[model samples]
Target: MHLRIIALALTAVLTSCAGVQVHRVTDRNQPGIRYWRPAPYLALVETRTENAVACEVRPLMLPDKTEEYAITINAGLGSVKATPTLTDGWNLVSLNAEADSKTSENLTALATLLKTGAEIKARGVTKPPTQPVPTCRGVFRVDYDAAGNFKGFSRISL
Candidate 1:
């Protein structure tokens, strides 16, 4: 009876771990490139610089598997979404900057107000605030096999 209980507990822990297993594969040729396989059909590539971080989500299986989507997060700015294009790949979706510290403070204040049921005022500004041009620190081109398995990634110029 005691052995049965221990067996059940062990099985539960192993099953949970399997569901959250992530494989990190590094390429010897490209030392800078990093790969993470979070799921069977999805792979994530990330590269970081002093002031910025970039990530790309490459689908292993898709009708047009050659495409890749990338996003960059700047220290001063929030997240910038990019879409792949034939001519200029990974075009910025928006031009918005969020001051990290100030944004966090504002969010905390807003959450406090909501908890207290305080009235909030909404203001509209005519002109959109201009932000500095976002720099592309590192861009990569991910390769996959015919069977939809990730081969590796190579650094590409913007």
Candidate 2:
């Protein structure tokens, strides 16, 4: 029995769950951290037991404007949390958007940030209500830049 329990524990440690997908957009015409889904990225998790699901994507912004955007998404069993922040990376063009900087100013925000044919990265997914270790159903990601500046964020619950 002891050996079986140990083996199970080892298996769980070695196994990892699939995470949500985040996409990037390149249309300069679009304003702000663009979050567009051409092909639907289906979330396989649940919204009840796995009540927390989110995904965030970092845009391929200009080297100078890269630092201006950020994204952060969080979720849990019962409820979820979100926040957005902007840095100096924003340029004159973003001034108008930044003035209201809704995402940056809003302490709690939930918004997708991306489009198609982009490098999709598996960010994070958290599952709360676990006895000991809080496991997540989907993914949660904080969109950041090369200089470590935040652009946006997301949380997905399947």
Candidate 3:
């Protein structure tokens, strides 16, 4: 019985580590007042649990990137809220559409990803913070632990 338990534990660890998927996606529906704002290149992940999210995130384009963006996932409520810090990496250019149907679809997609234990990475360029600022772009490698917890996001060359 002890041996069986150990095997199960080992299997769980391996599964958690191997179950995660990370990649870059363009979210054209950036949320905000401006309609012509540029879209952002987002690196999103789908893990097995919520703990897989990192307290900090560093992307290749914005190495100084932090978890300045707040994304809330309420699986029970089927809702999500993302607020940007307006900082260099978390600037509004990477924003998402909040109240529109397309935004709803996007959030729903985001919810599905998080519900399955996923993470997102987005970067924006546009230093002057101007209205016609360029879109944020970046590439990243997602790192996680065997226990299904997020370790960190490692910046990688595109």
Candidate 4:
């Protein structure tokens, strides 16, 4: 009976933590093509045990002067708000759209730095460039651990 209670309690605690949070954050510091407005990027945050364990950002489609942009999250496991089933290893969480033109440019520059063996920073987050920056049509694959912590991202082939 005591073991059952302990298992239930642990399950409840784990359930509360297994999810993903996504939002758009505007980076006014990054240069925009218009020279007056900074571009926006999507911030993907992973939570485990109700605490954010990892974060990554990707550029969104640039908004034209006359159009409004809205960001949405679509996960492979269902809504990002849904609790994910615990597994023994990593799971693919979300598949995001391709990099925008501005992002492509920034990524190209970062790739150059990588070739030189220099560290690179993307939107203030410094990490080594993993794979070649995808073109505007390439899709992004985001993965997470069993505990809902972000693992990393990979580009899907066209």
Candidate 5:
């Protein structure tokens, strides 16, 4: 009876961890990138220089298993919608920058870094001043490679 209770507890913990994987990944071959879907969840990627990337990609998985993603960028300044095609269960979606020219250039550089095994820490929080709050607010120090992704994410007070 005690063994059965322990098994059930372990299963509950593992099941919750499987949802929305947020951790440090050094190897470019890690499987986290395969499950990174930027849609239906608000991903707020803020850089060290305070240049921010806030947008969500709504993925429409078609009958043929291809996905079409859509999102609007920069709500206050101007809105720009971007669509990227996903196939073969993996695809790199290019997020077009809607900020000023310089900020846009910065985001391009960051995107390149993300594609090259750079680790970004993700957490869930309530963003301030917005009636409808966001789900995940990822704070990434533009320099940390793969150290801070995994540890102490749960200790972060929401």
Candidate 6:
């Protein structure tokens, strides 16, 4: 009975978002009693800068999969939705960033660092806002220039 109410509430929330489409991604990679959906995209943006490529990630996935949530990004030039993936070990998931010969290492480092931070936060070394309820959070949007250079990132929270 409780599960049904939760499912109904989630459906109602997801049904209310705009633009971005939502799809179910099951873990054919893993098996057993579990499941997860990242979040809905509220908006996306694409912009450029000299030293860093910044994507203003808006609302993003809650670390705890059981809650209803969404993610967004602000790219001045605009943005596109990418295929989603299971964000390893975190128990949350993420969207893939465009691959680039120009900035892959930097982007990869940024991503890795952030993921480490999230993991640490979840572990309670640093009391994060989500600390009260440690969750699997993923950074929402990634930035790539016209040349496909990944520059920076922003993770989703709540």
- State the lDDT at 1 in candidate 3: 100
For candidate 3, write residues 1-158 as lDDT tens digits. Answer: 99999999877544333111212223435332221212222343333455563322222333323233223322222333443334443333333423222334344545553542223332233222212212233444444479744455444456
lDDT of each candidate versus the true structure: 0.33, 0.30, 0.35, 0.34, 0.33, 0.38
In candidate 6, the residue pairs with backbone N, CA or C atoms under 3 Å apart (3 or more residues apart, or in different chains) clash, namely 45-75, 46-75, 46-77, 46-78, 63-135, 63-136, 139-155
- Please give the range of 10 consecutive residues that has the lowest summed lDDT in model 2: 91-100
lDDT of 5 by residue, 1-158 (tens): 99999999877643332111123344555443332432122224333445765544222211211222222233233333333334444433333333332334335533653443232113212232222324445422111126533222111132
| Backbone N/Cα/C clashes per model | 0, 30, 15, 0, 1, 7
Candidate 6: regions farther than 4 A off: 1-69, 78-81, 86-91, 99-113, 116-158
Prediction 3 TM-score vs. true: 0.19
lDDT of 1 by residue, 1-158 (tens): 99999999877643332111111223334321122211113334567899988754444321222222222222322332222122122221222223223344335433542332221111111222222213333433444579755565544454
RMSD of each candidate relative to the true structure: 21.7, 25.5, 20.6, 24.0, 22.9, 22.1
The residue-by-residue lDDT of candidate 2 on 91-124, one tens digit each, is 1121111112222312222122322112222221
TM-score of each: 0.17, 0.17, 0.19, 0.17, 0.19, 0.19
Which residue segments of model 2 deviate by more than 4 Å? 1-22, 29-80, 89-158
Residue 91 lDDT in candidate 2: 18
Instruction: Give the alpha carbon lDDT tens digit for every residue of 116-147 in model 6.
Output: 43543443311112211122334444333687
- Which of the two, 1 or 3, has more TM-score? 3
Residue 80 in candidate 5 has what lDDT?
A: 32
Q: How far is candidate 5 from the true structure (C-alpha RMSD, Å)?
A: 22.9
lDDT of 2 at 16: 24
| Winner by lDDT | 6
